[model samples]
Target: MPTSATLAQPAAKPASRRGFLASAAAPLIVPGSALGLNGAVAASDRITMAAIGQGPRGQFVLGHFLEQKDVRMVAVCDCFAERRAAAKQVVDKHYGNSDCAVYRLHERVLERKDIDAILTAGGDRWHAVMSVLASRAGKDVYCEKPISLTIAEGRSLIEATRKNKTVWQCGTQRRSNPTWKFVVDVVQKGRIGALRAVTTSFGEGPWRQTGVPTEEPAPDPEVFDYDRWLGQAPWEPYSKLRVRLWRVNWATGAGAIADMGAHYFEAVQWARGNLLELPVEYDGAGMFLKKPGINNIPYFYNVRARYRDGMLLIMDPAPKGVRYDGEEGYIHILDDGRVEASPKSILEGLPDLSKLPPPKGHWNIMAPHIRDFLDAVRSRGTTVSNPEAAHASHVIVHAANICLRLGRPVKWD
Candidate 1:
């Protein structure tokens, strides 16, 4: 889960991409400059990459980039010493390159001129600031899902990226998966016949927290700055789960809705024709499957979104798994390691790549996402989960949270 962080400082005005391109095109430095080997830095050369957050998802993203020979892990950043250490080990084990820098502060990583882009899995609160700041620092960014904490934040990120002309990619990898994309395309093209409703489910609900150890000593102030970690949200005692597992907290993360629902809601938008077009309203509830822990929140969350066009979307925690119901037929989108589509007929004669596109090698599909970002960076083109599409998807998750908070289905205007 991406943890929110306080902004270290406002962003610097980014150098124009055209200026960078012109500088590269000209032989100002000849073959060797301060960094050395100017001509050697071809477009096909290894891209210097960094990982800003090394939690589960962040580590997963790091693993994806390691598979490609054209990329190198030059740096990593994480607030938690343990997570940082874990990520560094993974980098060392997987990266073909021998030496890489690791830092506790993301700002330090952003300051490196050699790093071409960053793989960010920071807390939800940090999404906008980290992404925007990275863009301003002249680095491409591939940040995780639920792109923003608030509607304003989402819009701000878009503006920041546009202003900086950064290559921004969101962690909505399903967009790149051929199978999922086909499902979405079919739904939108009326293969489902007047798509009336779409539903999604995930999670066993929030984990009930046990009381924190009353006398547990705080982590070394030098290693992990607690104040910096809290950022914008109200302060609270640092619990293991609270700091590392911050996704369970409303202040730091979006609970299960923002954590898992972001993916589902984004898919919902993709299925319906409202991804770019906003929704009519969000109606939902965040209720507990168990008692709240140090961070009180619903372990299980359910929601139903109604669009103005009368299309309804229902999503609940995967009852041990997930499936989709369509107007013409139903599709089973599962979490039980099972991948089955509706009417088997849809994929009967589909080609190998068309049907399964190479299992991203990891259960998590973000690897292909990393590859897509690298490709887009070279092509100077938009990726499947571009910033705009991601921004729209985030609104679905944000609206869902708002509806639950307000205890009413607020209209989307």
Candidate 2:
């Protein structure tokens, strides 16, 4: 990884994953409901599960886990009381049992020995933090996108997952979609002629921080441990926007390009046949709106990077999708499950289209990806959206964010 004046190290390790779990042992007791699951045992068929960061995304991911008879969601954690309780309710309701444990801190969940794997859908800052800890604790991980807030954190996260031999999958669920696979295969196999460029877009986000509270509030330790949510992020006074709206802030997330563009460029990397390599250089300009919607992340931006292979990736303002241009034609992929190619007959160009996978029923977006993660857990196989690939795509846009932040184009080493 290259050093930059734009990317600075945080003051210190907020807390070591191992150290936090070890010291919190006395308080983080296993819930009585989790005990005596021995009767529920069905050999290795079941994956004992714990969930952290039970917000909207957390609750959603945990619901998918509970749908499987082979998954036992023993514990869940969230900084907010209402959300965590809501998660436990979902678990308890599913199994018709209150054996599910509730937690405010993720360290408690990590300290538990019962969980085989952890499903995390937390804030962008906590993604890398908890993934590293979960890896250290000898558990597989299913984490959300923009795996880390910065390129440096992503590199370290890759190290942890690789070292622990953890079966890790990022939450860029499109990778599991049969349509996306077919597209990647087509692009990689040169069915679209020689690939030349990729155009990805996510429209525009709130440029001006509005509809959010700007005043820093006193931390309500009882209602929500603001400090815990702010972990790994620099210490700052509690602002409703800072905690909840942190997703778009550069301090806590990589803004739209890395956070949302993660999906777009990741597929670009997949089609480009270089998932782990980043562009050698990138240049970009951004519109830093003075009207505040939330934080400092650009409300709108554009970046262009040239991969070493001379393939160009352009992210411009438009609808949310990736369009690949090649000599044969252009293929456009959207998140809503729309894939289009030029000449109309390009779909027939694939000699093995019959051998390619059939559509997996109706695409719910999250379902297939969850199925892949659970299957990997049972079979100990690699997931299609493993952490390594996530990291590579992450760095692509993360480097772009740096360019916007530093107000200069960057040369990535």
The local lDDT score (0 to 100) that residue 119 gets in candidate 1 is 85
lDDT (10s digit) by residue, model 1, range 166-263: 88898877666656665666666655467677666666654444344233457885577676677667877766656755666677876666666666
Q: Go through the candidates in order and give each one's C-alpha lDDT.
A: 0.70, 0.78
Which regions of candidate 2 fall more than 4 Å away from where they truly are?
Answer: 1-44, 211-219, 291-294, 349-363
- Highest TM-score: give the candidate number: 2
- The C-alpha RMSD of each candidate to the native structure, in angstroms, is 8.6, 10.4
Q: The CA-based lDDT of model 2 is what?
A: 0.78
Per-residue lDDT tens digits for candidate 2, residues 154-223, read 8888899789888889988777777778788878877679988888888766544544556676667758
Candidate 1 at 125: error in angstroms?
2.3
lDDT of model 1 at residue 88? 77
